[model samples]
Target: QSSNVPKLGTCITCHGRDGIGTSPVFPNLAGQKSLYMVQQLELFRSGARKSEMMNVVAKSLTDAEIEALAAYYEGLDPGK
Candidate 1:
């Protein structure tokens, strides 16, 4: 992965270190299906999933970045 990707940093703020969200309002991304994570990220990027913060955050990600993020989160163990 490249050091230039920003979504990883942006994600940690709400989704926590590895996509285990800080609270109920923020859904846990860790252990989620990779394709599902990609879909939601795309939706947020395209404004289909209406979230002011996510819309802007997702918009900043490229397709490669999205895929990388999905894979990163999907690989996490939710139980941890």
Candidate 2:
């Protein structure tokens, strides 16, 4: 994983270290399916997804970073 929670630039702004979003507009990333996150992130990187914020963030991420982030988020306990 090239990226860690602390190393995350924009993600940590909305989705915190625990993957829980700080605002209602930001969807919770905790315990989400890794594959789903990977797919969505890939789409966001490729401009297939239409989130202005996500696109900018994903654009700077590598494949390994994306997988790492997805795994990290998926492992978080939403019930926490």
lDDT of 2 by residue, 1-80 (tens): 42544346668789987788999999999899999999999999999999988998899999998998888889889989
Clashes of each: 0, 0
Residue-level lDDT for 4 in candidate 1: 51
- Point out where model 1 deviates above 4 Å: 1-6
User: Global CA lDDT of candidate 1, please?
Assistant: 0.86
The C-alpha stretches of model 2 lying farther than 4 A from their native spots are 1-7
List lDDT for all candidates, in order.
0.86, 0.85
RMSD (Å) of each candidate, 1 decimal: 2.1, 2.4
